[model samples]
Target chain A: MPAYRPPVIPASEITPRSVYLRRREFMGLMAGAGLALGVGDARAEAPATVPLKTVPGSYKVGEPLTSRDDVTTYNNYYEFGTDKADPSRHSGDFKPRPWTITVDGLVGKPQTFDVDKLIADLPVEERIYRMRCVEAWSMVIPWDGIPLKALLDKVEPQGSAKFVAFETVVRPKEMPGQSGYLQPMPWPYVEGLRLDEAMHPLTILAVGLYGETLPNQNGAPIRLVVPWKYGFKGIKSIVRISLVEKQPPNSWNSLQANEYGFYANVNPGVDHPRWSQATERRIGASGFFGSGRRPTLMFNGYADEVASLYAGMDIRANY
Target chain B: MAMARSPFVDRLTGWGIYVIGFVPAAASFWLGATGGLGADPVRAFEQTLGLWALRFLILTLAITPLRQLAGVNLLRFRRALGLLAFWYAAMHFTVYLTLDRGLIWSTIIPDIARRPFITLGFAALVLLVPLALTSNRLSIRHLGKNWRLLHRLVYVAVSLAGVHYLLATKVLDLTQVVHIGLVVLLLGYRLVRSLIPRPERRAA
Candidate 1:
């Protein structure tokens, strides 16, 4: 195997902590000036808000992070609702603080850890990554968390364990959609990865975004971040992690196996039966209509780091 | 028979229907112009326009049935209602092309070809073009007998629009189901009405 070389991220793409915090202030001053000059049209839009400080980590993408508003407001957490804004609107009353995640299955030691205690024990780092949704939308998000490997190491996997299955918390009362008869998909949204992918350096268990604790809408407390795969592969508000021998059934794949395959790697070559995967709309780049679409990258532009895992396998067939 | 109404009353009613037809479009425009459409304003705007188009199409289909079943003579405003539906549908298509697709023919062509939902929506829009063009009195007079035949295309367009709505939405909820059910009933009434022979008129 060849030695790994981290991609060189240019300094210009990075948003410094000070600049991010002051951006809201700067925009407010501009709005005030515009209003004073009788050009109040510009002030009609709401002022931007400061995001939580996400300290830079080793795995950083040289791209401007999406605005905090877009990141929070535009989400696809079906547990809350199917619409992009549903999570933000419906998840306000959700209680993410007293959370516990259980690790069982084929692990050497099965135990549960309180979310707060886990965060305290593991060192947190911020990773800016390009999150590509299967719906053909993309966002550059600054995520704060520990590597999945850090957590998996604590729950020593047995030799027979070939895959890692993840399960999200299911509180029907808090997650309205889950309780209702009109559930979008099966409850406790489950996802899985090969044992190697779980241990991959690119995969992290994200607890926060933009330097602050994860917003309820953005999968508060903890969520998985698999940079090379589609955003749905990163299950939110996880409660269970199990090591298994065979492949586990995922929420989407189980719902519509043909549409959403288990692998779910962001491969541009494989178009979703419903929509084209050739291009994606960047959430915050364009104006009200859209910023316009750019060609989708293979493996969501993380092919360099994760391509080796699928070297011999037929990605098209797997997808 | 009751006494005939005054011309002022008829004209006022006609104008009322016309103005009310545009209220949804006007409200959507106002919401979009302001920042009230929320995070993804363009999507909200496009969806609102599309929904209004479907509503107008449903209303337009109901006019003939209302007259047949309940003796409600809304036939006078059918042309205006059909035209309004066309207007909203045209605006919906324009937003999709210009704002959503950025008028990129390469992407647009593929989307129409590959996506069944887009294809159905585009087909509905195309079917409405001749109906809209022939809506004026001059074209109505020119086409004469053929005008009725040409306008029958509306049935096809409305059905396609129903399918388009079903395909576009992520979930098939009660609202969508009811809308489609209403469309089916309206179309079924037309079919049954046509199938049954009309009673011969008695000598006055």
Candidate 2:
């Protein structure tokens, strides 16, 4: 391994910045045996050049190059057209303003907050996270958003809250494919997560990427991005957030029942019938070009940190 | 021989069709050029071109029947349309190989080898190459009757194309089923026509 440069916060760079997990909290998280290694250990200081891996310690992060002008310019945003690049041209019709999200269902506080008001109450933190799509492509984006937990706390989930349901705006005129699908999907694309999953520190409510306010095609205004799960799990153009007692019907699951389960925790071993999820292609790598794909990790390698939460549950079946 | 109302009009109409056929390709390119290809622009571009390519391929396939029934023909335009179909199809495959597979030949080789749908598409495109090359009348005259027999591969090529689309989507719905049915109908026409009895010629 390259000289053990410590791993960075890997968290949102929020103003009045987050106190990097208090020593007590870190010690408590590690428990007795794990804490013996010392508290607040952010891995070794990672070298500037390590072969990047989905999980740390697997490879060196050799270069900082993770994006390219060509790839970024040509993207596949399905909201605009079936083609990766159509959205950028056709999405001018999408109106991100006058947008509001209704926080209700099983929350202690139920209220709808408009765009400006929403951000005013919560802060936008710049977070650098790797986003992996189920189609096997990935991009390491510096996304700006609020911690999902922080947003969830604002909603004040009731004791009955077991799940979090999210919905994107659906307008056929703006989103032509809203009804033009060969396959059927519940419009206003829906996605959800268990209460704990929703609150995972890694989960984020993204509003922007690459520092600027989100462009319309990239789920302008607001979207949920769970870096650890397949990209589909990150529903965009969200207009609704509901804390519910039952699992919400997610778009992909409603479309492919068995193929896409309710809990789409990233699993390398379980393959989608049509394709393998074992590997992901990291776009914009150097001479490597598209060769940087590596095996996906369970819980996206956040398992050791979050796996115990699902102890004894067969992940294969869940997957 | 049919007389033209105005040779310039005919020429303009011909140019018009060429421009019309190019519209879809141009629009897709414009999207790409404008940086609107979206999060998966490579896929978006590929799908646009691929879908249009398939539509054009089907249009190319439908030409004979339309001509036979409607007495309408565009033999002069056929070559250009066919070439455009090939160009789009090539772009489709290129997107799959480069953007989709990340240009890893190893991944592409196995996909072609193992996936029958991909195999069919690859084979169909492969068969088109020589037919496309020898489409000229000089080559047709050189090959004699054999030229017609070779060009008949197009019927099978299109069926393969439709099947590739159907299987790749993995959908067995009526949209694709209708496509398959049309292919069957086309082949059926040829089969019945071949079986028809012809008048006997007097001994020379």
Candidate 3:
């Protein structure tokens, strides 16, 4: 075998790294537009169970894990539909395999990785997290995935990148909720996190739930799981992660800013106008008449680990 | 073309309406007993009761329109329908208090006082009580013209309930707007009807 040699090329012919990155961003933009248009051949496919191998994760909640039945059936994946049961009922046709996530924007290495390949490379673990919803419902979930910082580290975010923006797959053809006469929200559900929040140890990119690859309704493929923030902050079925200079718009906040703030930390003191956040009805915790409810802890009981993230900021005002 | 019917047929039809009206409440009980109310049974049960109450209120309001526009005389069933609405609304509040709020008066009182939707809903329920109590013939005979005047409060009760429903939802989507739209249309019809001078009424 002869030693490989560099191809003879003029210095002017070489494309600058910035230009190449811009081209990738353009391609990413086109892919997003194509998804929004409901391009043909993006037909729905049934999601099958794919078990995952995992080790014990670091942030394990002592509370009883919510039943897998409840966790799987009850979901807020608006892509599938708005109702809790709609996701489970209508998501059978959604396809989660052959997925790819593009991590670009202000990063040194702008690369798109196949989701399966990324999952295989990551150190997957089982983390039991307490998820609190702004609607005042709580659940304890055992998620299987790697820390989000692990993925951000690979992309090598630039110093200018102050926030991380996430975008969900917008296939109206397969996802029933994305279509129809009355749309619940703007298409391609978007969420964002301050750079520090994205790099927090407690945050994870969950690949599986209860040892099996995520069911379509439960944000199959991969989803962000920020243990401290309200569950809406955990965007599902993410297709894009762009690190940018300014804070990105959040779906709920964009719809109603005063009600749903960008920093949706689970604070019991700050009451939602519609309902009190002081308490939450723990789903599937007890009998019919006895709705298992408990006092909501600040930061969803993860205060010890995450309170410093907002140390001096007025939580009520931020809320 | 109103069809004249015998007393037996009228009584049978009235009982039939009540039987049919009670079916939803019974079905809800069965679902709660069998764990068919889904992940959050309390919320499911509470919403189901509340929705049925609103539906029954709509039906009560529709009786007048049906009689005038469609030549359908459902007048005999209006009281039964109004009573059903009251019962369902009461049950909705009961579930919220006992199951949803765990009968905690401390939290429940504050919830009613602070949350505008809850306050509106509670006021609606309170307004419905007097209407529900005076729905019988004895009260109609005793109260005379005052009975009709008092029961006009249905408009206020339903309006409050409609706004309460709209406010309770997190997002004011098209469906929610349409839900309250029906009430607005029904109430608007009554206003329009009252404004138009009926030749027959003026001659009488």
Give the number of the best model, judged by TM-score: 3
What TM-score does chain A of each model score against the native chain A? 0.82, 0.75, 0.85
Q: Which lDDT tens digits does candidate 1 get at residues A1-319?
A: 0111223434553335223322442442323221221122212121222244445688777777788888988988877767676677667657887899999999989999998888778888888899999978888998888999999899899999999999998886666556533456657789999999999988999998888788887887899999889998999999999999999989878766778899999988898876788888777677565535778899999998999999999999999
Worst window of 10 by summed lDDT in candidate 1 chain B:
B169-178
Clashing pairs in 1: A52-A210, A53-A211, A54-A211, A286-A291
Specify the highest-DockQ model's number. 3
Model 2 per-residue lDDT tens digits across residues B1-204 = 254558788778767766776666666666655654433445555666665566666667667777777878766567667776777788778767765666667556766876676788888788778778887779889999999899888777777777677655422332444556666777777778679886887974
The reply for model 3, stretches above 4 Å from the true place, is: A1-46, B1-6, B172-178, B202-204
Candidate 1 has a TM-score of 0.84
**True-vs-predicted CA distance for residue B201, candidate 2, Å:** 13
Report model 3's chain A TM-score: 0.85
* Model 3, position A157: C-alpha lDDT score: 96
The prediction achieving the highest lDDT against the true structure is 3
List where candidate 1 sits over 4 angstroms from the true fold. A1-55, B1-19, B192-204
Better of 1 and 2 by DockQ: 1
Candidate 3 lDDT over residue span A1-319, tens digit each: 0111223435454335213322332342223221221123222344677899899887888788899889987888877766677688668767888999999999999989898999889889999999998889889999998898999999999999999999999886677666654456777899999999999999999999999898888898899999889999999999999999999999988887878999999998999877788999898888596869899999999899989888899888998
TM-score of chain B of 3: 0.93
lDDT, residue A35, candidate 1: 22
lDDT of all predictions: 0.79, 0.65, 0.83
